[model samples]
Target: MTSAASPHLTGGPETLVICGRVDADRAELTPRGELVHGCADILARALAGLPATVARVDLDMAGVHFMDTAGLQFLDVLADHGRRRSLTVTATNWNGQPRRILELAGLDTTDPLTGLAVTDPLAAAPPTAPASSAVALERAECLHVLQEEVEQLRQAIASRPVIDQARGILMATHGCTSDEAWHILRETSQLSNTKLRDVAAAVTASAEADGPPPSPELRTALHRAVARRRRGTGKAT
Candidate 1:
């Protein structure tokens, strides 16, 4: 295995290992978090060295302790590039903050983590129907409306790498896939009775801070604090 303390570099099997901190200070600042320039550099290098017949790229994040919006954007760019190349890109060891970030971005998936042999979690759930004919159409309509709302929220935050980064962080932290990460975010938001955007924003902010992600218990407390503060002063307004 390659050392995880060096600059990001490409190795065998179309894999790229990004070691060390992503230098959040050097990244461009946005409402989300810092954006690392090094990510772009790494992506450019990785693309330049693409081998013929390469089907996927694996990004090992076990050693990465910190990243910002730019780093998240870099991953997004890499994912897009891989899609364009008709190649799949898998990000591993995406637990903790990194996994959470990716989950927010909607890029973390279990297929890669499970070596592509497992079934999709979202696809496994069966659809539900209304209990009576009187409200069957109404239930269907409600479900449709909910789906539309979800789609709208996704579209509204679609291009924001901060959201994606939060998703990634959750994926890593929970050992979940991208879809599972998203479900967790959504579920958390519902349980806490908070908006998805607010939850995502909080996750991004926590990841951007110094040090590793707080423990799950700490994370829950922080989320509650943030929510309470938002309610009290509307400071985030």
Candidate 2:
């Protein structure tokens, strides 16, 4: 059962598709689609804001089971967009009904191991599979989606240890508590238009080099957050 509604998480706002940590140049999107038949427009809208670079877009379609004409058409459209933008759009881990559909549309979604193109659809007939086969495939799709979520959760939690170290460093340097340090991290993330994990990673890296915030940009953003908070409260006694 593919759900278009957002997936509720504990901390922040819910993200429907759980896109892999998108940086400036690349994005990995794993759409949890049981049947990607009629929702091309919704998917397209979700993928619109590509960073102004030749994005290496990797579409992980392991979770999709069924794909109709509309789904294949969307892939073609995405391929065209990639060519126009000099991007490399590749969809991988396709099998069963979805793979058959893509093959008919002339989109080469080949095997994971060999990187060799699977059999030509025109050269051979599509295989006839049983209902149990589909059920098994659906199960596999669910497992793949679950694994994706698990990996995302792991990355989300992995940031905390480093962020804690950064918080301690900030507390010692600025005479602030853990909460105030977190405020600085959140504010810097907001002001610099960067993810909190990235900010934490930078701070950790800086500590390795025996320095403050790794970059001047980070330094500036950190101080700006403190300044803004101070201004709101007036002069501190």
Candidate 3:
């Protein structure tokens, strides 16, 4: 999906691929550029037709390397257009400065990296109408992306409870700040050679069994956190 685009201002490589069109109204863009004043016009024009559809528009930002205020304003314009047109615009695969800027600006970056809008238009066709193989292939790809996203979300949610439980256990035992507790948990996980989540679950489980200790709170948090690790290795805890 990556290829050299036209020469940039510096006569260097700049690439942007917008694929996954469900219809004339919706599509996805994968951008790779030093988005600055030099390319702001091009970027704006590229973004202009993005919201032509009345429903969803997804954008994958994993390709964008850099973006400046001009580029930021261009995205703002795109978002405003989405609003005016009642379009559901979303972006994902964010990292680094782009992610920070989007967060600061309070933009939506939760669009799945797929396109499912490929069906509604074709739905009204006669029941006997043959489906386009190209559309079928695209839809299958979209479903695959959606499935991967669902699995990722499930893993994240599953991990959150144990992590939070471990954090709380640390806070209560160490009398430490949340950040400090997190650091302690992370450090302990590293030192004990246990996966962080497994260590956290162990901590919570141990706390549940023995209850919180009075004066030996720190020892308990650390000991219980690593004991399961030792026990798993056939070592006496």
Candidate 4:
């Protein structure tokens, strides 16, 4: 039998969809869509919605074209569920950007739920000696840095569409080139002491008929940015 789970997120409609089919004692799950912020929760719900008779779960991730760091959490959800329910969970058939993301996050691309890097035989070997306090501290710091990088990447991916829209708006309104639009947005963001993505979102939203205008600070900064660009290019503002 096939099953699906749907969950609501704050900002937008759900992007991930989990479809499952059950065999004798195993369930095959295929998740298709962009795995963004709340997708891990959806995966959890999907696992919980599985039939009680399912003793094993295999996820085929080929259809998942895009995934951010939340994909790691999705694997965690499956692993946690499998442990709690005494079920075997294996994820495979990962390809494209999702697979590359898995590699970047240092996960087992073949079967991340097992937390074993199958490609490297030495990774499974026991540690030769306990890590010293200094070494442990360094490792922890490295992990913190890695987490920050992953979060930055995720935010960039999430913000790209809005940023592009903002750039397009500026291009159309001012008859500026795309690079000039980007420069204006960046300058305005810096001048207004705001995030580039936030500035882009404000610019995009203000262009809509019913959307709220940007804050006064953003407006002033944006004006100055455009005026400066006009002066630099020897064009009328």
Model-by-model lDDT, in order? 0.51, 0.61, 0.55, 0.80
Q: What residue runs in model 2 are displaced by over 4 Å at the alpha carbon?
A: 1-20, 35-37, 111-237
Better of 2 and 4 by TM-score: 4
Off by over 4 Å in 3: 1-12, 15-20, 38-40, 49-54, 103-237
lDDT of 3: 0.55
34-143: candidate 4 lDDT, tens digit per residue: 77788888777777777899998898898888776666677777877776787888989889877777776566788776663232446535465554565557545645
Please report the candidate that would top lDDT against the real structure. Answer: 4
Q: Please state the error at residue 54 of candidate 4 in Å.
A: 1.0
In model 2, the worst 10-residue window by lDDT is: 7-16
Residue pairs with backbone atoms closer than 3 Å in model 2 (clashes): none
Relative to the unseen true structure, what is the C-alpha lDDT of residue 172 in candidate 1, on a scale of 0 to 100?
Answer: 76
Q: What TM-score do all the candidates reach, one by one?
A: 0.32, 0.37, 0.35, 0.53
Best-fitting candidate, scored by TM-score? 4
Q: What's the lDDT of the predicted structure labeled candidate 4? A: 0.80
Candidate 2 per-residue C-alpha lDDT over 68-164 given as tens digits, one digit per residue, 9 for 90 to 100: 4455455655565565565767777887766765444444667321222223335233355576587558645644554454456558778879889
Give Cα distance to truth, residue 188, candidate 4, Å.
Answer: 20
Q: Which stretches of candidate 1 lie over 4 Å from their true place?
A: 1-35, 103-237
Looking at model 4, residue 221 earns an lDDT score of 100
Please identify model 4 stretches exceeding 4 Å from their true place: 4-14, 116-237
Lowest lDDT sum, 10 consecutive residues, model 4, at 5-14
**Per-residue lDDT of 1-237 in model 1, one digit per residue for the tens?**
222323435323323344422222111111112224455566556554554555555655564543434455565566565556756555566455544444444444432333222234553343544435535565456445544544564566573675688789876754556775666667667766666666677776666758455447546854554455445544452
